[model samples]
Target: MDDTFPKIEVLINNLYDLKQKRDGNFEASVKRVLNMLMVLEKGLWRTTRGNPSSFTDSQVEKCSLQLWNWAVAENTLSTISDIDNAKFRHVACKLLTLSDPSSINERRVRLQIEMCLNAAQAWIVCGRYEMTDDLFELARTCIEKLLDGLAGQHHSLSGSKRMMLDRDLFSIDGLQFQCVGSLGEHDKAVIAFNCVRDKLALHPKEAPFLAMVCYNLALKFHKEGKLEECTYWLRQSYDTGKAEEEYKVDSCQQAKTLRFLAHVCLQWEAPHCWINALNAIELAIKEQPNVPGFLLYMKILTLSEAPDTDLISAVQKILKHNLPSDLVFNAVRMVMQNGRESACKTCLPFVCESLSHTTCGLEVILLKMEVALHFGNEDEAKKEAEDLIAKHHSGKMLKEMQQEHMHLLLWGRASFHIEAKCYADALVWYELSASFYAPGKLDCNLAKLYRNLATCYLELHRLNKAKESLSKAHRIEPDNPTTIFLNLRVALFEGDEQNASHAMDCLVQLANQEKDSVGRLESLPAEDQETPC
Candidate 1:
């Protein structure tokens, strides 16, 4: 018997009594806790020597929990706070060694894993986003060690044991990726993701696990802005997850994956995002009808500028859900840009009610601007725009959306002016819009901006400026019929007959291309007054 066991027991007894006091002397208590862990480390090794009496597994579990509590406590002693984190892995690794051999009892091995996992979870709950990576790393090391040892023992294990092992391994691998991603180590996260992917490959029959692996990878890459890879993995996760009893995966997980895939498609401007999202949500709703899933479906359905199918059924479904006021208001805002008077009117009452509430006031206000423009209520639209400017606070989401709103409102005013035949006013507004939204930037309707600016200049008889705007618009969307037609007009105005004839011939060919796309024009201006056609 190890003679040191007696001294260790005495140390633990004294430390346990001191900890039970929960005295205000946090530094003194942490120092005592460190002493206890140092003594417990020796005791953990004794369990490997077939000495069951040397240390109870419960003692290790309790110590692990105590250390976790100390680490995350808001008022933890600063001097010893980091000590608690450093000591955790030592105790966990010591316990891992105890669970090493098959000679160790199954109950003891399971207890050690559970204790380590609890410790890992504490790191997540207690550590700030920047500090949790080390916590997950400590937890992952223990799990990986366990998996490595268990792989050799798998042949003798029962089916249930195999499943438990697989699940634990899968969970830890996923947690590691999530933690790595949170730390913004994209390369490291991909390594962890690949590890999970390779593990899933080993068990090809586990569709749910496969989906989970893909789902996590998709999410990580999506957050990293690797959109192509994100889309690929999202499609894999969604497709595989939709296969069996609808993947027999968690309903929320299924819904989230499908929603993410739809979002990915939307980000890529894929033609099938809406249809696939609608179908996926329908299936997901049947399994577990969640508001987020439904709300996401509504976003896709209503926000579509040119949906291939009627969205009335989808919108009605949302109304039938009798969702919370916040969600209903949000849905109304999404459909506000649909440019359909009837649809916008259907949501008008809730939108007005939403404007009365505080949550998302800016978003609701901006949507009101768009909705007003949809109805050609220029005065109301102008009021909402001014209101948004008054209430605008600086934030990333708000700033981006605010810029978009300003651009569209400016465009709306220009269109209204053109429709009203106020040529000089149209020219002023269109020129301001073209300057605010430069032609070469992504996420701006630059082609239309330039084309319409050309139109405004032409109306004002600024033939040279009209030709310049038309040339810029042509470079962006070379084959756009509106751009080509305007190019012909600019050439004719400048008496460049050869260029006018070429522009006319190109316009005819593009008209054929436009006809081939029948009912699928990707670049139709939101307001019809954008072009002479």
Candidate 2:
């Protein structure tokens, strides 16, 4: 009845012919045919007064599929190249209009939702945020229609059918949540998260989706530096995803969430941070059983001052897999610090093997220096330190781990002098190590650094300097028995009986069980270090 109908037929026939060819000009001909179809599509809508379904025949389904395939291809390419925006928008609009739930069959309705979501993602990648509105709206409309159809027949649908329905709805909602989050609509993202959370118990397979939503939101806040909110969402993700195992969902996501949570806890002063970090990494290792997870676990244990036995066990587990140089070096550091000479020796060869394969030769060589010092090979250690410093001055070290390795080297050099009773030489390295950190900042290493500095001054009979260093250490860690004991020693050396008596009483109360059981300062000076790096 419409004059444009024949034109559309001719265009489609030409499109079929173009598809049958695979020559140099096939792409051009296809584009020409698509353009002709588009023109006729616009004209048909302008002329038609009949029901919309009158146009959604077999020709329409075939056309929709072809257009969808083209849009998908273009959308993928848009990630790496620019696309024709005007043409993309025209095709998307036609797809949305033709996908109306009131016009297309149920199968086409579902296909249209998929198509719209694909287009919405492409538009997002293309930075056409405004164009996503219609695509998403059409998707929601199709989802709502599908949900309504399911609801009307809920009484007769089987349990599996009901589950499938819930999954489909939840999946759509989850995708929209992710898109809203990517758009930086924080409030809407939270609402979407709550929507998913509220319906979480309706289907067991929905846990992974909920976990992904929480993880994505946490990442957004993390990038924005909103640590408190980021931590809250990560906690939600790990807790909700923990039951993924019981529900038969993939446990890898939960493992990754745990690992990330551990990383965050290590940086922030979260409640029971070290304990939580240890627990999270331990669980992560169990869930995924991979090398990186094991490496993280070993690092956490070393920082947390877990017993040497635990560190040895982690090393043994790691030995079964291909060892990374960093992992081997860390393992050797922990064991050597714990006075496990045999364990350190066992791990050193692996470090050498792994080192040969990586560009991180500076770190591996530094580890060798520490081992030499631990074995009382003073000349070897001194020569290695000089070589390391010369190499550093030459800028031969890789930039990524240079700073961290240098800090460790400085600390090791300082601790070596402390053990040899070379107070003046020790004093210089300690001060140099302290200078590497920001002024007035305090951490485990800084706290111990101040304590050791006070020790050097005390040995040199610089009573005034000893008291000054003790004061700094005390302010940094008030409850440390070692700091209190150092304060007591300073008071004794200063002949200040009153302060000495007070420090003694505090230490007694701290020990409680044995008055003589006052904690010794950390023995391995290079050990028990916790750096953000």
Q: Write the per-residue lDDT of candidate 2 for residues 1-533, one digit (tens) a residue.
A: 55575566566566556546756886676667667777777767555635454454555666556555554554455521333433444464454454333443556666666667666656655656566676677777776776677567563556765565566667666667677777767778778878877777776676776677688878988899876667677877877775544663466877888888788777775447878888888888777877668867876777777766677678776756655656666667767876777667667666667565567777766787778777876577666666666666576654645556666766776766666768888777677656555556777667777787887888888888888887887788888777777777778888999999998888778878654556443242422322323
How well does model 1 score by local distance difference test?
0.61
Give per-residue CA lDDT, model 1, range 268-387, as digits (tens): 665566566566666766655667877767766664554523454555556566555456556655665455577766666555564456555676777777677767777787677666
lDDT to native, each model: 0.61, 0.68
Q: Against the true structure, what is every candidate's RMSD?
A: 17.0, 17.3
TM-score of each: 0.43, 0.51
CA displacement after TM-score superposition, residue 25 of candidate 2 (Å): 5.0
